[model samples]
Target: MAGDRVRERRTVETMIGMYCRGNHGTSAGLCAECAELRDYAFSRIETCPRRDGRVRCTGCGVHCYNPVMRGRIIAVMRYSGPRMVLHPIMAARHFLP
Candidate 1:
């Protein structure tokens, strides 16, 4: 539901923020590249047909993103996924079973 959508949005935002800060030296807001990715991610999340709370985008059947965007997001997640522990709540939500 709505809570799931909000949680997903927050999770992506946190991951993108961590990636932007660490990789792009952005302290307060996203860089232009990160901002574009963030916007694309948010839009995709909003339009995703599979709204199942248990089904993460990584595991979903849908291939909603274009190739370039998919590659970009994959990189972001790969970089930020392990670093999520810095954010305790998001880390738990993301890494816990």
Candidate 2:
């Protein structure tokens, strides 16, 4: 499970990297959406009940790296059971290359 989570994180990170490169590579390490997500995630971390201080996907047990930034992600996956499973599709729409 941990391995899978790591893989998912890496995949999302890679996608964010590609999105940033395609749009605004010279500005910062992350794009606007990714940054927003990061900020959102950070803001919610203290309040969230997850052990690692992250919002996890109920369906997959995948932790959200930027939970606070994307409300839609949380909303869509709120029914995924124990895991939080923010939609990769949504993240892709806003941040994927």
Candidate 1 global CA lDDT score: 0.87
lDDT of 1 by residue, 1-97 (tens): 8888888888888888988998999989899999999899999988999986778776788999999999989988999888888778897887775
* TM value for model 1: 0.90
How do all models score by TM-score?
A: 0.90, 0.36
**Who wins the lDDT comparison?**
1
Model 2, position 77: C-alpha lDDT score: 34
- The TM-score, computed over Cα atoms with residue i paired to residue i, of candidate 2 is 0.36
Regions of candidate 2 where Cα sits further than 4 Å from its true position: 31-33, 38-97
What is residue 19's positional error in candidate 1, in angstroms?
0.8
